[model samples]
Target chain A: MINIEDYAERQMRRRGMEITYARMLPVVVRRIADNNGQVLVNSMEFDAYNQYWYLVNAYELPVGTRITSDTHVTLLETHTNDTMEEFSGKIKIELPASFTGNVCQALFYQVLVK
Target chain B: MTGSTRVIHHPIQLIVRQPLTPVNIYTVLPGHIRRVVGVKVVHSVGVHLMSADTYLPAIGYLSLEFNNRSYHMGHVDVSFDNRAEASDAYLDTEIDIIPGSLLSGHYENKVFTGTDYQRADGTITDKWSNYIVTIYLKALSDD
Candidate 1:
C-alpha cells in the first residue's frame, strides 16, 4: 500500500526539506440539481499556514460523473487514471443531467505536508 | 538489490456485465512484491461500440484500495480511450506492497444511450455491450 505520510515525506525531501508532520484531509462537496440540467461545482481552494497541500486522489459519488480541473482538463487523464486522480492547481466537478432533483457528491483526498 | 529483487508484472482481469452499478474485484499479491512501480489498463475493444451512428466508449469509474487503507487511489475513467496500449500511457506510481497484501479494484459502469438509427422501413435501437478489462501492475519483487 502507498502510505500517505511516506509519500508526503518524500515529496518534501525532494525540495530539500523535512516533514515534521503529515496528514490526510478529505474535502467533500455536494450539490442538488433541481431539474434535468447539469450542476456545476466551482473550484475549491485550500489554504493553510505553514502547510503545503498536494492532491493525491479524488472520487465522484454515484460514479461516472465528469470531474475536471482548470475549466477543461479532466482530472484523471489517460492511463494515469488507474493510478491516481492527480491534479495540480484547481479542482471542479460537473454533474450530469438528472431528471427531477438529484444529489451529486464529490470527494477529494489531499495530503498535508508540514 | 539486497535480496535479488527484480521487476515483475501482475495482471488481473475483470468482466463487466451490468450497467449503472459498481463491480468490485480483488487479488492477493504474490509473496514477492515489495513496491508497485506502475499501473496500466487494457480495455477490450468491444467496449467501444458503434451504435446509432455514434461510436461511444462505455464510460466507467475505477477505484483502487490496497490493504484496506483509509485513503483510496481513485475514481478514474477506464474507458476504451484511456487504455495503456501506447508507449506513454503507463501510469507511474510508488505504492509499497507487503507480500500477500490484498489489492481491491472497483468499477462502476455507466449507461450511455444514443439516438435510434432511422431507416426507410424501421428504426434500430442502440444497446450497450458488456466487456472485459485487464489491469496490470508492474512492481519490484524479490523472489
Candidate 2:
C-alpha cells in the first residue's frame, strides 16, 4: 500500500507538474445605478486563462459602506466571450435598489485550477 | 523580470466640472511603455460633499478606455477610489498597448452642481470650481 504523500508525489511526477497551490486572482466588479434610481447589473468574464475558475471570496467596496447584503455573485459555466471549449466562466453580480445612483465596487477572488 | 523590460508608473490628473457633462482626458503612453499592468486612483478633491449629513462622494462615474476597448464596462470608483492609503486600491490586469497609444479617462459628475454645494459647517457656497482626480498607471516598458 502506497502512502498518501507518495501517491500525491507520484501523481505530480506523472503529470509533469509541480506541487503547488491554487492561484488566486483579484477582480473588481462594478454596479452602476441608472437615472431612475435603479442599480444596474454587471458581469465579468474570465477568459484570460485555460483553467477552471472558482469564486473564493467577495466583498463590497467604498471602504466604510460595505453593504453586500443585496449583492449577488453568480458563477455561470457557459462561455460568454468565445465558443471555444476551454475552461471559462462568467461572474455576474446584481446590486439592490439601495445601491441606486451610486457606483459600487465589489472586490472578489477567483481561484484557478488545472 | 527581464533586463530589457522595465516597470514604470505614469500619473494623470483630470479636472472635472459641469455637472452631468463628461470630462474626457487622454495621455499618450511614452515610447518605453509596452503594456499597462495596473491602474490606481491616487487622490481626489471636491468629490465629497462638505455637508455633515452626506459622507460619500458625489454620485459620479469614471471609466478608462484604451485600444478601442473599455477596461470596466461601467463606473470604476469602487475599485479605484481615492481614499486608498497606498497602492492597495488598484485594478491589476494586463492591457496591451504600443508606443504612443492613446489612453483615455472619462468622468461625469452626476449630482452636485456649482451653486448647491453645502459645506460641513452648513455653509452654502460655489467656491468648488472643479474636482481634481489623479490616477496612476503601472506599466511595463521594453527598453
Candidate 3:
C-alpha cells in the first residue's frame, strides 16, 4: 500500500540517499509440506558502491489450521570480505509444515544506493 | 582543498506501512486482515566500499522489534576493500516474521563515510554518519 514518492522521500531524509523509484519483490513458498521441509528458497547478491537494505513483508502468510506457525529465513555470508570488494549475502527460506500451496508470500524492496 | 566532510546523521524512525492509493499508511492491520490466516517476512542488507577509504560505507546496526521481542540483526563493514573491487560484507543474517497478531519492525542503517571527499580529493577524516534506517511492518493488507 506504500507509494513510491513517499517511500523515496523518507529514504532521502533518513538515509541521506535519494531514491528515484522503488518497487516490491515477492518472496513466496509453494507446495510446502506440513512437516519441517527445509527448502532452499531464495538467494541474492549485488555489487554497488552505495549502502542498501531490503524491506520484506509477509503477503500470503504463515497460516494453516492454526492462526500461524513457525518459519525461518536463513541468512548466510556466502562470500567473505576478502573474496570480493563487495558487501553481500545469501538467504534461504524455511517453509513451515503449516504452509502449503503458494498462499504464503512476502513483499520486499530492492534499494539501490548511489 | 581543506576537506569535504560533514557529520552525517539520519536518526530515521521508519514505520513500514501500507499505502492506500498514493499515501502509504502506517503498518496497522485492519479488521479484515486478521480474518485471513497470517503472513511471514524475510530479508537482509549489505554494503561494499569498492573504492576503499575513498567511499567507505558501513551498517552501524539493524534491529527488528516485534511480538514484544527485539532482535538486533548485525553490522556491515566494507571499507578496506580495494577501489573498483568488491568487498563482501554480510550486513543482516536473517529476519523471520510470523503471522497472527499485527507486527512492527525497526531497521537501523547507521553509515560512516566521507560523502564529498572523493569529489574533493579523496583525503578526509573517518567519522560516523547519522543512523539512516528503514522499518516495515505488516503490509499484507495492501494487496
Candidate 4:
C-alpha cells in the first residue's frame, strides 16, 4: 500500500489547501418525520453507536393550533461522539381540540460513513 | 521468460457528495455578513446556497462532529446572503472555513450562530431564516 498519509496530502492539494493529515467523515441526514407518542423521533443510530444521540438545530413548531402544556419539549443526550456523535431527540406539543392531524412532529437523521 | 510488471500510481481525486439532509429556507439568510442558525448540517460546498436568493459567505466554518473520539467541533462564524433579489449564476461563491476548527471524521449536526450576526441592539442570534443550502462533502471513498 502506498500509505494514507500520501493520500491525505493529495486530497489537500487538490482543494488548494496545504498538505495535512485527517480523514473525511461523511455524516448524512437522510430523513425527518413525525411519529406518535408525542415524540419526534429520528432513526439516527447504528450498532456500534449508542441508543441516545445529540440533538442539534432542534426546535419546536406548532403544526396548526397553538399548543399549551407543561410538557415542554426536551432534548435528552443519549450518546456522544463515542461512536461518531449520533443525534436523537423528542418533541412534545399540546395542540388545541380543533387540530386534526399530529399534535407534534420531528425530523430523522440518517448518517452514512464510507 | 518472465513478463515485466507495470507499476501504476492512482492519483488522488476529491469526490464530492450532497448532505444527507435537505437544507430548508429558514437556514438561509439575506445579508453581507450573516451567521446561519437552526439548520442541522456539517459542511457546505462551492458557496452554493441552493437558491437564487441566497449566497454563502467567503469565509465560514461548518462544525458537525469531531474526529478525536473524545470531543466535538464547536461553532465558528460566517455571514449568509439571504437577499430576496440576489442574482443568479453565483455558483462560484465559496465560504472560507478555518482549517484549525475541524478534523477528519468529525460529523456535525446543527449549524448555529454567526460571529458577526448580532441584533441592532448588539445581541447574538443563532438562527437562520429560510436558507435552503446544499452542503457538499469532499472525501476519498470507494466508487
Candidate 5:
C-alpha cells in the first residue's frame, strides 16, 4: 500500500533532506539481513524507523570496496546527494501487525562511491 | 547422410519457478546497537554475460528495515565458479537470491557499509570480488 515515489519523498524528509533528482524511482521491495540475522522486506510506508533498517550490508568493512550501481543503497531516504550528513533524520519505523520480525532490510539505489 | 529421411523439429519449453523469499528480525535494546535477526534467503539464479561492452542487468534489490528506515542491500551473487568459462553473450545478468541469518541486535546501518572491502577502484570489479555468501552472528546476552 505504498507508492515508491512517495516513499522516497517521505524517506528523504525524515532524513532531513529533499529530493533533488531528475527522475523518480519506482517502488521495489528487497530483503536484507538485520542485526538479529533476520530478513525483512523494505516497505516504503515503513521506511521511517531507524530501529529496523539500514542502507548497506557489511556490519563493518575497510576502505576500498567497489561501489557499483548494484552496491549503492538508500536506507531511510530514497536518494542521497553529495553530502553525507543529509542521511540524518529522526523517524522510528513501526512494523505492521502482520510484519512479524525483529529486523529486516529493503532495497533501493544510489551512485556508487569510490 | 542424404536428405532422403524426414527431419523433425521439436520446440523446447521453458519452465520457471518462484525464487525463495527470506525472513528477517529487527530489534534494539536500551543500550545496544540495533541489529537484524532471523534472516533467511536462498542462492540466486545464475547469468552468463559475454562481449566486452559494459552491461547492467535490472534485477530486484534487497533492503533491511532498521530504526524505521528502508536501506538498500546489493544484488544477489551469481556463482561463476560453476561455469567453466564466459560466453560471448553480452547482456545484464539478473539473479534472485535468498539467504538466512540469526541476529541479536548490536549493529548500525552505517556500519554495514563499513565492511572490509578492497578499494582498488571505485567499482567492485572482477579482479577482487568481495561478494559475501555466509554471515556469522554473535548472540547478545539477555539483559
Candidate 6:
C-alpha cells in the first residue's frame, strides 16, 4: 500500500513546498445492490477542502468472495497555471445502521497518512 | 523471499531530474520493493491576466503507461460550470489498475499544453509547454 502522507511530503519537497500540516481522515466505503442481487460499486466524491470522504455501503459482502479490490482513480485539472495541492486521510469501509446481515457487511479498511 | 513478498513503506522516495518545461521531459523511477501499484492524481488550474492583452490559460493531458502500453480502467471525469472563475474551475479523475500481470517496468509519459494570445487585429501567437510526470512500478526482483 502507498503511504499517502509520505508521498505527499516527498512530492512537495521535490517541488520546493514546505510541509505545513498533515492530517488523516477515516475511510468511507459504500455499495448498492438491486433487487436482482447484482452488486454495484459506489462512486465517491472526495472533498479535500472540506476534509471529508463519504460513501453509502448498502450491500453486505461475503467473507471469501471477491467483492472488490483496490480503489481505482482518475484526476482532471480544470486549469493550467495552477499547482496541485496535497492532503491525506484514512479510508474505512463500513455498513449503515439501517442494514444488518452477515452477508451484507461492508468491508472496512484503515487509511493512514504515513 | 520471492519478489511478491517485499513490502513498500510509506512516504515513497521520488527523484525529479532537471528543469521541467513545456518541451523537456522527466522520469519517475520506481524501486523493486512494492507489490501493489496504484495512482491517484488531482489538480485545479485556471487562467489569469494583468490586462486584456496579457492573457494566460493552461491545458494538459495526463495518462498512466507501463512498458509503453497504457492500461485502461474505469475513470471519473468532472468539469466546473463557469470559465471566468479560474480558482473554482475543478475537475477530478481516477483510473483503476490492471489484473495479474505485475506492474514492473519503465513507463513512458508524454504531455503538452498550449496557450494563445490575440490582439484587436486578430493577430495571434500560440505557445505550448511539454509537462509530464512519468512513474515506474515493479516488484522486488530478489527479496
| Top-TM-score structure, candidate number | 1
Sort by lDDT, best first: 1, 2, 3, 6, 4, 5
How does chain A of candidate 5 score by TM-score against the true chain A?
0.23
> What fnat does each of the candidate structures reach?
0.00, 0.00, 0.00, 0.00, 0.09, 0.00
Which scores greater on DockQ, model 1 or model 4? 1
Top of the candidates by lDDT: 1
lDDT string for model 5 (B20-121, tens) is 111123333222222223232221222222122233222223333323333433233222222335332222312111122222111111111211221322
A18-51 per-residue lDDT for model 5 (tens digits): 5555232232333354779564542334232222
lDDT of 6 at A86: 25
Better of 3 and 4 by DockQ: 4
Worst 10 residues of 4 chain A by lDDT: A64-73
Model 4 lDDT per residue over B1-143, tens place = 11332222222112122121111111211122121112223123333433243655423333333222212233333335556654332122223223232322212112333333334332434432323323333221222
Q: By TM-score, is 2 or 4 better? A: 2
lDDT of each: 0.54, 0.48, 0.31, 0.28, 0.28, 0.29
Give per-residue CA lDDT, model 4, range A1-114, as digits (tens): 233344434433544445222333332322233465343432222332321222222233222222111111122222211212233222222332223443234332332222
For candidate 2, lDDT tens digit of each residue in B84-141? 3434646886887756766755665555544466343334457444667677789898
- Over 4 Å off in model 5, which ranges? A1-5, A22-114, B1-19, B24-31, B34-143
Q: Native-vs-model 3 lDDT? A: 0.31
DockQ of 4: 0.03
**Per-residue lDDT for B33-75 in model 6, tens only?**
3233433222222221112322223222232232212232322
Best by DockQ: 5
Off by over 4 Å in 3: A1-5, A32-59, A63-92, B1-143
True contacts kept of 3: 0.00
Q: What is the lDDT of residue A38 in candidate 6?
A: 60
lDDT of 6 at A62: 24
